[model samples]
Target: MFRVEEPINKAADRMLKTVQLGIFNSIIVNRLWTPLQQIKFFIPTGHGTLLGTWRRLAVCWFAVCGFIHGIIEGWFSLYYDIIPGDQSFLSQLWKEYSKGDSRYVIADNFTVCMETVTAWLWGPFSFWAVFAFLTNKPYRFVLQLIISLGQLYGAVLYFFTEHRDGYAHSEFGHPVYFWFYFVFMNVLWIVIPLVLILMLGDSY
Candidate 1:
């Protein structure tokens, strides 16, 4: 009985590994990218090129982060609802997050238009930016700098607008979420993009 069970377990383990490897190849190879190519994207060709180690890494970070963010805010929230007229869980989640945001609750015409435009614009730009950087395309950092500046501008305007509404709010939600996720997230977008802009300028 013990010997028979041992063979069954070994067979099951092999089957599971095969399924996992297949899933990995399908996701990475067919859609996202090849592992070898992704790895190659990380290595610097030289110091002066735009595809240098540090610049590529920074652009990669911006592109990937924007890609994930774009899907939620740009596609699900704005585009999906506009096209097929479907309001999804993703859009609802954005509203849930917006309860903590003045732009949603403040009832101002200006914030309404601004927020709507940004959401629609960011989704496509984010995807394009990621693809551009990964393919070693030019102007990646330049676009990133523009996006970062927009992010910083929006964050500042929203914060001041929230304050003026007599909310006296500094955090996005609770203290921990507010500081790390909300405040720090916005700050780094400003800082990193500016740094990359300077680096690129020097490179040219």
Candidate 2:
């Protein structure tokens, strides 16, 4: 009687264990096959290829602009107070606008203009956005969000820090132009090549 009861109990135990595991797996499968999950994959990997390409291009563009800005900073540091004698495009423009007298508002205006321009250019932010979309990197999403916020922060800084004393006129200038240039320089040029590589299925 004991031996017969032992076999019956073991069979029941096995069935219960099997049923528990089955239920657990079913839950997992439901989670995996949910509409949200499918849509997430579909947007990045399937039907949104063009948007992905644009995003990659944006990243590459900003990277280049960042490099250019880095060079300009280095040059500015080395040549402090000694404006370049070169008649290159930027130099000529600087000369045209920068009257050497304090009453002319050249120094103050120049600082205000550049800070506002750089803030608009916000290379890091544009690159981050494109990178997030193209690579589908979750970290990229966080970085992109940070970049957008940083641009806003930069704009505030440009106004509060550089133009604090009301030395510069609080009127219409190149804010819109700066915004467009910043986006174009950082995103359009930088991210396009890498995006093309992705299209070709080559490792970046």
Candidate 3:
């Protein structure tokens, strides 16, 4: 169940902002697919032969990262002030995700600034990295290195800040909420970026 500290109508004016946004209840009728199944959709048909499986997967990872940073985190950067009480699909998604990190529900300052930078900066860079790789740009590895380093830095700060707070933002040990939502989800940013960085090092 999605819960928050604020009243449902606390941001009545902001509710108007999401009138056109569809409700998640009606939009998400089916169960989510596994990551591997979803990745198939991101593989570029023209580039598939050139990319091979691992390279295609890496590109798909950047595509996913771009979507999350541009669309999902971008929404947070815009409407975070109204999230706890907002009823839009994205708002509801944030509320659900907040179960693992209550800082989102409350719109913590650090989270807001971090996500804003990520949305504006890394978001577009991620897409550019995809394009660079697909077209075989001379600077693809440089872009990859910058983005991976930035993601690594941001992710480390995210975890470190939460750790300093004694993990008060989450349930800490709840199997799904803590382990899957908080740790596992954020850890991907750390692990994948680190691997990409190492790959860049090998290429040099």
Candidate 4:
């Protein structure tokens, strides 16, 4: 005789399917970006018609922003270099690591700072998209919710991961603007893309 399935096993399976369905739905809808307002919260009020015309442009703008960020921060290492110090941030970073006298949690992994900041900024973009979806189609909120959570996860991982905690603080002697500029640059870099998305009529 065939054995019956365990209740716990069935429940777990159902939960997995629910989560998988939610993620799948988010990806499908986000890629198509069809229901503009519902899937993209940055869509300002009274601009549904323009979404189609500007959607691709908006996406391209954000893509460019992302690429620029990667090039400057990831490739050229601008943020980690060219500061007011004689040595590049990475050089100091390695020096600190070698000397066993690190100060900040994010010191060792300079790249972590870049990743964390970018992810944090991108969270809003995804959030608005999900918010748009929820407002128009409450039933499909689960999908958007999953996507938002994933974005959030990315941001959190960038900041709190142990590997990223290497250079949490700076050891340099500098003005407040030094730190402020560093942060502002990263924030603005990400904001531009988000703004472009909003200008195109995405809501949230």
Candidate 5:
């Protein structure tokens, strides 16, 4: 009877030890799983894919305007004081479309510096957007969002600086063109940033 009781006692001890080890493993797994899920932050998700759909129109818009701002306007700002300087494509442009009592205000020292900075900034982003679009790189979603915010900042500076002087006004200037160039142009920067924030936020 003593020998039989000894084996039964050993068997009970082994069973209890196995159950404790299982509990320990379950606790460890739960703790590790949460942080692993959070690491998903680095990867693009549903909303990022959604924003990708707008790549054609959105990136194109940035690319085209960015070329004009970074190159065309940049060249003019560097040379002319927003006045009709002798003759050039850009100067001709200013003469045709620009309207103001002090049109030179657009290329004032302050405005020229801002445009130059924006030109340098937008040039790289436009290149990146085009490259990313062609490659279908998901990481570009985050880049797009970042650049969009920067664009918004630059737009605000441009708008307020222009506003301090005045908007383009002439006897028969089209409200349509004024709104298109000054209002809608800057407004898109603000709007697109918000859209990118919403759509690319999942990647955060």
Candidate 6:
């Protein structure tokens, strides 16, 4: 079972009062299906596509990214002010993820702005990239390059800002919170995007 700690920043006390977070178990439940279920739903199961395996996986990645940015992060951008107190599934999900980075619960300025940009810009573009790839659009690689670059840049800023703050937001070395949630999860944005950028360069 996972437990939420008090906000690390004293300035967050006022905001924390409005939050009614509960003890989160490793398995988070909501009215909707789990994230894995959602991902499975998005992933193409057929091997009939003209695209190769790696290309199909890339398309799946963008589809997942679109869902996350458009739906999940979009909710955060819209309702972050009330998320701590809100018990909606998406809100609960964010609350759960806040265990890894409390800036989300406190609605830190950088987080809010960054998520807003991600939701509005990259969200739609992700879906567009998926569509372009599936349809074999001439500009598919262009979209991939742009989206991958944005993701990489944003991810760099995300980590660098946390480092600059001396990693005060969450427990630095905790297994689930620090290593899995904070580092491993966010690092996908960095590593995968870097790979896609390199692949694009190779294609040129």
Candidate RMSDs in order: 12.3, 27.3, 7.6, 19.1, 30.0, 7.5
Candidate 6 has a TM-score of: 0.76
The segments of candidate 3 whose C-alpha lies over 4 angstroms from its true place after superposition are 1-49
> Please, what's the RMSD in Å of model 1?
12.3
Which pairs clash in model 5? none
lDDT (C-alpha, whole model) for all candidates: 0.52, 0.41, 0.77, 0.39, 0.56, 0.78
Q: What is the TM-score of each predicted model, taking all chains together?
A: 0.56, 0.36, 0.76, 0.29, 0.59, 0.76
* lDDT of predicted model 2: 0.41
Error of 3 at 108 (Å): 0.5
lDDT of 5 at 60: 56
Give a tens-digit lDDT track for model 5, residues 1-204: 122455877767644644554465356445544443443344343455433335455555555545656666666566656356557655654453453223433446765666676667766676686566545576777668767777778778766766665543422243433553346535877787777678665643
On the 0 to 100 scale, the lDDT of residue 27 in model 4 is: 68
* Collision count for each candidate, in order: 0, 10, 0, 27, 0, 0
Error of 5 at 86 (Å): 3.0
lDDT of 6 by residue, 57-87 (tens): 6777787788878998999999999999998
lDDT of 4 by residue, 1-204 (tens): 112455888657644644654465356445545543343444432434333444433443334334433333242243333322437544443333322223222234544454445444443444444344333444323333443344345434433542354433432222221233233323443454445434433333
Off by over 4 Å in 6: 1-49
Worst 10 residues of 6 by lDDT: 23-32
Q: Give the alpha carbon lDDT tens digit for every residue of 22-139 in model 1.
A: 4643463334333323545354433434354564465455554455455544543344323323356545444433434434433356555555555666546666666666665667
Weakest lDDT window of 10 consecutive positions for candidate 1: 77-86
> To one decimal, what is the Cα RMSD in angstroms of model 2 from the true structure?
27.3
Distance from true location, Cα of 123 in model 1, Å: 3.0
C-alpha lDDT (0 to 100) for residue 181 of candidate 2: 24
User: Residue 2 of model 4: what lDDT?
Assistant: 17
Once superposed on the true structure, which residue ranges of model 5 sit more than 4 Å away at CA? 1-52, 100-106, 164-177, 202-204
Task: Give every collision pair in model 3.
Answer: none
